[model samples]
Target chain A: SQTIHQWPATLVQPVGSPLSLECTVEGTSNPNLYWYRQAAGRGLQLLFYSVGIGQISSEVPQNLSASRPQDRQFILSSKKLLLSDSGFYLCAWTGGYNSPLHFGNGTRLTVT
Target chain B: TQLLEQSPQFLSIQEGENLTVYCNSSSVFSSLQWYRQEPGEGPVLLVTVVTGGEVKKLKRLTFQFGDARKDSSLHITAAQPGDTGLYLCAGAFYNQGGKLIFGQGTELSVKP
Candidate 1:
């Protein structure tokens, strides 16, 4: 079975602070990884996606960035956080095209 | 941009009642997926419909993919309180690797 692990699960940071959220998948190799943010409790905005190591496609222009260091390890980072950056962050993985995505528990970040 | 619009942005219904949620799009999709998210957790994959006019049933939940692959519907029979959560519909393009377009999401609240 495939499982995705994401952390810190919850985060509270000050404005202009750096941010790092990690996601890893087990039982799969070279899977497609995605980063998404949900605000106002509905819908999700795609942040980034990776099909292989060292390759990342950013979906939106924002302060946040994503990287896939290893085949199953993905990281979402930001040099400086904004008040609008706070939301529910989710990490998901899929086998390939037309495959259903499996998501991690998610991280709730609050920027104060 | 290819967008998926979900109707009835919010739904509140009594237990044992039936409800339907629709996802519409002007663009064609190779596949459509349904997900359910609980509070404080990531969205979980409920089902995926690939072929046009395909219908899949999972317990009391019934999902249908439109003939043109431009829409989908989810009908829940004898809804229970446990079914209360956010429902999301995602569509995938043909051979698009892992890129998925998400709908605005439907918040369903079933009162027991």
Candidate 2:
């Protein structure tokens, strides 16, 4: 079975502070990873996706950035957090094109 | 950018009631997926419909993909309280590097 782990399940940070959310998957290799942000009533937006290590495609150009350091490890980072950056951040993985995405528990970030 | 639009942004129904949610798009998709997300968790893939006019069933939930591959629907039969969650629809344009675009989502509350 595949499992994804996301840490700092809940985060509260001051405005302009740095933010780092990590996610990793187990039981799969060379899987495509994605970063999504679900804002209040705004739907789930694709922030970034990576088909392989160091191959990240950003969907929305914002203060946030994503990196795939290892095959199954994806990190979402922000050098300076904004009030609008707070949302439910999700990490997902899939095997191939058009495959079903499996998601992690998610990180609830609150930038105050 | 390819986009998905979901109807009934919010739904509140009784436990024994039946409801239907829709996902519509102007562009055709190679595959469409339905996901359910709980309050503090990532969206979980409920079903993926690949073929045109394909229908898939999971317990009391039935998913149908439009023949044109531009839409999909989710029907819940005799919904239960446990079925309450945010329903999201995502589509994959296989030829477009398989990036998944998501709908705004429907927040369903099945009251008991």
Candidate 3:
């Protein structure tokens, strides 16, 4: 069975502070990874996605960036956080095209 | 950018009631999927409809892909409180390698 993990489950960051969120998947290799953010009661906004290590595509140009350091390890980072950056961030992985995505628990980031 | 539009952003119904959520798009997709997400958790794959006009059933939930492969719908029969969650529809464009464009999502609340 495949499983995804993300942490910290919740985060509180001061404005302009650096931020980092990590996601790891087990039981799969070379899977595509994605980063998404959701505002309260709103739809998900795709931030970035990676096909392989060191390859990332940004859907929205913002303060956040993503990196695939390993086959199953993905990281979302920001040099400085903005108030608008506060939201629930999700990490997802899929085996290939048209495949179902499996998601992690998600990180609730609060930028005050 | 390809966009998916979901209808009835929020739905609240009593247990044993029936309800339907829709996902519409102008562009054709190779595949479409439905997911359900609970509060504080990542979305879980409910079903995947690949072929146009395809229909899949899981327990009390039925999913249908449009004949044109541009839309889909999920129907719940005699919904239960455990069925309450956010419903999302995502589509994979042809040759897109499963990079999904997500809909705004429909929040469904089934009360006992």
Candidate 4:
């Protein structure tokens, strides 16, 4: 069984502060990872995705960035948080293209 | 940009009622998936349809992929309050390495 873990299930940060969210998967290797953000009453927005270590693709231009340090470890970071950055951030992994994705519990980030 | 549009952005119905949620797209996809998400939790994979015109059943839920692979639908029979949550549809193209483009989710509330 594959499982994903995300840290800081809930976060509260002041404006202009740095942000770091981590996601790790177990029972899978070299799986594709993705980062998504969902605002209240809005659809999810894909922020970034990584195919392999040191490979990251930004889906939309935003204040966030992503990195794949290890095969199953992905991180989402921001140098300075913005009020617009507040939302539910989700991490997902899939075995390959066309495959269903498994997601982590997600992190509720509130920027004040 | 590839985009997926979901209809009835919000739905509320009685527990014994039936409901159908639709996902539409102008571009064809290699595969499409349906997911259910609870508040404060990540979306869980419900089903994935790979072949065009494919239909899959998961207990009380039935999923169908359009013949052109440009759309899909999920039907729930005898919905329960436990089914209340956000439903999302995602599509994957052949060359995208399984990266998914998500739809504007449909929030369903099944009341007892």
Candidate 5:
């Protein structure tokens, strides 16, 4: 079965610090990967999605960016974090356009 | 912009009670999906309804897609405490790759 792994499970960083969150999928190759952020137990905001390596579509232009270094490895990064950047970050993968998304456990980022 | 709206942003009900959550959209979609997420975890895909007016049941939970393919609903019969979670609805458009537009989400709490 396919599974997604994301880390660190929880993060606490001071404002203006650099951030890196990684996600990788196992049991699947060239799967579509997505990064989402949820604020205060509400809906999720799409950050970025990648169809293939080096190809990323950003939904909301903000302090964050995404990269697909390998087929199954995706990374979300930021040069400088803002207080508003803190949220529950989720990584998801899907086999195709119509397939249901499988998500990782998520990372709770707290920017103080 | 394509958007999804979910009703009853927060639901608190007792175990054994029946509740229904709705997701509505003005724009049509190729498919609709429902997900459930626990605290600090990524959303888990619960069900996907493709065809118009499609109805699918998972254990005590029932999902229905609107005839217009622009809306969907999830009904839980005799809800249990384990069923408490944040429920989200996502819609996918044809040709949008694997990107999904999510709703604001419905937070359900079933008290035992």
Candidate 6:
């Protein structure tokens, strides 16, 4: 069975600080990886998705960026955090077209 | 931009009642997927509908895809408190490498 791991589970950072969130998939190779953000209790917003190493497609233009260093390793980074950047972050992976997505537990980031 | 609109952003219902949620879009999708998420956790895949006019049932839940492949609906019978969570619908385009575009999501609260 394939599983996704994301960390830190919870984060608290001051404004204008740098941020780094990592996601990894096990039991799968060259899987498509995605990053999403959710508001209070509502829908998810697509942040970035990677098809392969060094290939990233950003959905929304914001203060965040994504990178795929390894086949199953994805990272979400921010040079300086904004108040609006705080939310619930999720990492997901899928095998291919028409496949179900598998998600990680998520990270709750609070920017104060 | 290709977008999905989900109806009734929030729903509160009593136990044993029935409810339906809808997802609509003008752009055609090759496939659509439904997901359920609990508080403090990532969303989990419930079902995927690929063929137009296709219907699938999982226990008390029934999902239907429109004939045009641009819409879908989920109906739940005898709602339970365990069903209280966030429901999301996502659409996948053929050329996006199965990248999914998510709707705003529906928050369902079933009171026991």
Which candidate leads in TM-score? 6
Interface RMSD, every prediction, one decimal place: 1.0, 1.3, 1.1, 1.3, 0.9, 0.8
lDDT of 6 at A25: 99
CA RMSD of each candidate after superposition: 1.0, 1.2, 1.1, 1.2, 1.0, 0.8
Q: Put down candidate 3 lDDT per residue, A1-112, tens digits, no spaces.
A: 8899999999999999999999999998899999999999567898999999999999998999999989999999999999999999999999988888889999999999
lDDT of 4 by residue, A1-112 (tens): 8889999899999999999999999998999999999887456788999999999999888899899989999999999999999999999999987778888989999999
Cα RMSD for candidate 4? 1.2
Candidate 5 chain B lDDT trough over 10 residues, lowest sum: B93-102
Chain A only TM-scores, each candidate in turn: 0.98, 0.96, 0.98, 0.97, 0.98, 0.99
Supply the TM-score for candidate 1.
0.97
Candidate with the larger lDDT of 3 and 5: 5
DockQ values, each candidate? 0.82, 0.75, 0.81, 0.78, 0.87, 0.89
> Can you write out model 1's per-residue Cα lDDT over A1-112, one digit (the tens) per residue?
8899999999999999999999999998989999999997898888899989999999889999999989999999999999999999999999988888889999999999
Per-residue error for A6 in candidate 2, Å, reads: 0.9
List where candidate 3 sits over 4 angstroms from the true fold.
none
Q: What TM-score does model 2 score on chain A?
A: 0.96
Greater-lDDT candidate between 2 and 3: 3
lDDT of 1 at B12: 98
Residues B83-110 of candidate 4 have per-residue lDDT tens digits of 9999999999766666899999999999
Q: Which ten residues in a row have the lowest lDDT in candidate 4 chain B?
A: B90-99
Report the lDDT of model 6 for residue B46.
Answer: 97
Count of clashes in candidate 2: 0
Model 2 residue B87 CA deviation in Å? 0.9
Which of 1 and 6 is the better model by TM-score? 6
Alpha carbon lDDT of each predicted model = 0.93, 0.92, 0.92, 0.91, 0.93, 0.95
- Write the residue-wise lDDT of candidate 6 on B1-112 in tens digits: 7899998899999999999999999988999999999999999999999999999999999999999999999999999999999999999987666899899999999999
B10 in model 4: Cα distance from truth in Å?
Answer: 0.5
Model 1 chain A is weakest, by summed lDDT over 10 consecutive residues, at A39-48
